[model samples]
Target: MPVGEEVREAWRADLDPKIQAVRRLARRYGARLLAADGMFAALSATARPEHWSADGVHLTPAGHAALAAAWLRLVA
Candidate 1:
């Protein structure tokens, strides 16, 4: 498989289950889950290279701004 497909497969196999578990635990505790995974997935679908670092594991400044915006929206 290509590198992109590998990454997507890893996300589905690894990160997705962790996100689901956290969402479930947050609901059980009545805590506010940030839902960053869904937001990042949506942003990734837009194919915005600037939002991600060259390593593809970290966020760029634009990505941080977007995260802050999401947090504000959640708290507001």
Candidate 2:
């Protein structure tokens, strides 16, 4: 499938702040970036990777690639 705007939007809502902080770190070396809703929610709720995956251990290669590609967009 072609890369589309919805991919970026979903990543932003569910993943962008993490990616943005990573990008900032790449550009700023040791400097810190601001935290957002992710941290606020983390403080109030349990952390979860399963929320984003189908199973605890196994993930389809497409799923892995989609995750990797999202990060690659930030670094690239």
Candidate 3:
């Protein structure tokens, strides 16, 4: 499930810039940056509302599992 409109707005306005800054810093420091946004987007494309919490800002159990799977793939 894609994020709610309001959440998407907030992400674009607030979180996205912060995430980008973090990525830039990681690059500057020659540190590994695990970019999870794409993974989350992919999951959201396939997931249901139940995958997220009621507030739609947090992950539910299934969402966490999906994220873990993505993280494992990145690490492996």
All models: lDDT?
Answer: 0.76, 0.49, 0.72
Model 3 agreement with the true structure over 1-76: per-residue lDDT tens digits: 5557887687679888898899999999998767767566666578655564445567778777777777788678
Cα lDDT tens digits for candidate 2, 10-54: 756867677776868857896443342344335224534334334
lDDT of 2: 0.49
Off by over 4 Å in 1: 1-3, 47-50
Best by lDDT: 1
TM-score of predicted model 1? 0.77
lDDT of 1 by residue, 1-76 (tens): 1237678687679877888899999999999889987787788788665454444567778778888999999899
Give candidate 3 misplaced runs (Cα > 4 Å): 1-4, 49-54
Model 3 whole-model lDDT (C-alpha atoms): 0.72
lDDT, candidate 1, at 13:
92
Could you tell me the lDDT of residue 20 within candidate 2? 77
How many times do residue backbones clash in model 1? Answer: 0
Query: Which structure is stronger by TM-score: 1 or 2?
Result: 1
Order of candidates by lDDT, top first? Answer: 1, 3, 2
Worst 10 residues of 1 by lDDT: 48-57
Model with the higher TM-score, candidate 2 or 3: 3
